[model samples]
Target: MTKEEAKKKWDLTRKMLEITDDEYNGVTQEDANLRFVKMKLQIAVYYMQLLDEHDSEYQVPWNKEQFKWALRKPVGDKKKQQAKEWCHQCRLMRDKTCTNWNYEEVKTA
Candidate 1:
């Protein structure tokens, strides 16, 4: 897929998942817990795209850092809670970006 197609797919996935700005920002920035979720989501998207390709042995474009993140799943209640929060934040961010990429509009008062 082209770059625009991939971006559109990412945006559409975020919207369909109802991701909010807080969640998106959490992973995009310095939130370690949420970053895991972001990586997982991106990884999943990559795999999905791979499945759609006719070449089954095609190599995915993910780097080392992404694989490292995707390899570690959240364990225990506390970590799970953090992961849940991250999912929520990500969903919110996705939703916000689906429309306009406005910072102020995404901020909740």
Candidate 2:
């Protein structure tokens, strides 16, 4: 898909899921990408179910195991690093030592 299409899909999915700005900001980029993939997988599953309902003998061609795996949230080192940095910055701000603090974290936190 084109970048615009992907972005539109992501935005729509985010809205439908009622993902608040604070919740979205807390996650790493990788986590956001995974959520997008999971949303797409869910949409596919819904479409397949509709097809099944229309025709009882219709079978989904995709492997269910792969879908299950794709739906799982990934744990990664980047997320941990981001969290540590965020905590460090928070501590710095709390101590009034940080001159150039990240405003996004504060807004979301």
Candidate 3:
């Protein structure tokens, strides 16, 4: 899928959730855990195309650093409860631009 396509999807999800509190509590039995899936998807989509390791054009970088940056910490700064918020924001902004790319590749055909 193209960046615009994934971005459209992400925007839709973000619009539905607008606020983190609404997102965390609105979904039943989720307990704020699954609330991050949306933000994670943002990071995933960004990493798939927009990272220094790869050119501006769509290219996948298969390297240890990429894997480490993407997978080492799905939840950034897990030590603090407030950290979840940071993690969600970081991933949403594509701070490392790695998380969702790996997962999307796995789940995709």
Candidate 4:
């Protein structure tokens, strides 16, 4: 089945299972499997959020110079290393010096 169809099926199955103490006693194997899938999905979503937050922390402002640098073809290893260092420095400076980094500007740009 397609991803959307599987998602809809999972949602429907989860909704059908009532969350109550009494329902725990007679849990069928199918119910257990569905619960396991639901738990895995929850964990996967949590990890994805964590990864997104981690990536955002490393985000640097993209000005004209940076944009131009990014568009350059056949960048040398030295240039790539320099760029990585510059990005790292930017993140450090942002954390230490800039107490209020303009997130709205970053988001808009």
Q: Mark the 10 consecutive residues where model 2 has the least summed lDDT.
A: 48-57
Cα lDDT tens digits for candidate 3, 1-109: 5545555644653463344666556755343434454455334444443432322233332233533343333433332233244345444444444454566543441
Of 2 and 4, the candidate ranking higher by lDDT: 2
User: Which residue window of length 10 is worst by lDDT in model 4?
Assistant: 45-54
What is the descending TM-score order? Answer: 2, 1, 4, 3
Residue-level lDDT of model 2, residues 1-109, one tens digit each, is 3334444534643354354465467677666755455444445433333333223233334344643444345734443443334334334334352223366533432
TM-score of each: 0.30, 0.38, 0.27, 0.29
lDDT for predicted candidate 4 compared with the true structure: 0.41
- TM-score: which is higher, 3 or 4? 4
Q: What is the lDDT of residue 17 in candidate 1?
A: 35
Candidate 2 RMSD to the correct structure:
18.9
Error of 3 at 13 (Å): 7.3
For each predicted model, how many residue pairs clash, with residues at least 3 apart or on different chains?
Answer: 12, 0, 2, 0
Poorly placed runs, candidate 3 (over 4 Å): 1-21, 24-31, 51-109
Look at candidate 4 and give me any clashing residue pairs.
Answer: none
lDDT, ranked from best to worst: 1, 2, 3, 4
**Evaluated with TM-score, which candidate comes out highest?**
2
lDDT of 4 by residue, 4-90 (tens): 443553464334333345434436754444334334334333322332333333333344475345324434444455444544555
